[model samples]
Target: KINKGGQLSMKESGEKDKNECHGGDSRFMAMTLKRGRKKKALEYLLKKEESTVKAMVDLKKKYA
Candidate 1:
């Protein structure tokens, strides 16, 4: 079954199996996904900053 987050969850046979659905696994998975996304964004920002600094240095050297 697809959950509201578009993640495929186990379609439990019991309607009262709410605990199984909202257990630690789903929470852990969400945290892991956030961590991966955060890491990627940080890497991208660092690379952009590095390129901007390099460009500034090159421009200063050209004008000097």
Candidate 2:
């Protein structure tokens, strides 16, 4: 799925009942910067950080 800017969604699903999402946040930022979209990249980075934090919290809860 593409977002509003025609960017590919980072969300994905796996065969083994696992949801596999790419770490495309940084890559997306890189691409945006290359295209001279610094502000957009920064916004994406913020959202990416939130997602990372949520993932970390989930992992900790599962393992701890």
Candidate 3:
């Protein structure tokens, strides 16, 4: 945490700052996926979600 003067506290060292803009190691981007690869992954996820929703709808129709 920072003080009102916008400076880190004594217990908060500069190395503890986790902001990616400040050159922190981001675990989220650690995969190193390419742009096209990311697009394909997202499309696959969307298709899976769509199929799950469709199956749920069909199950509801069958029971309700």
Tell me the whole-model lDDT of each prediction, alpha carbons only.
Answer: 0.41, 0.45, 0.35
Per-structure clash totals for the candidates: 0, 0, 0
* Candidate rank order under lDDT: 2, 1, 3
Off by over 4 Å in 3: 1-48
Error of 2 at 46 (Å): 1.2
Which 10 residues in a row give candidate 2 its minimum summed lDDT? 14-23
Clashes of 1: 0
Q: In candidate 2, what are the lDDT values of residues 12-64, reduced to their tens digit?
A: 45232122233333334445566766576556555554655354334334433
Per-residue lDDT of model 1, residues 1-64, tens digit only: 5444343444456352442356422343344345655454334334334543344334334433
Q: Where is model 1 more than 4 Å wrong at Cα?
A: 1-48
The number of the candidate with the highest TM-score is 2
- Write one digit per residue (lDDT tens) for candidate 3, span 1-64: 4433232333334545333334222221222232334554344334334543354334334433
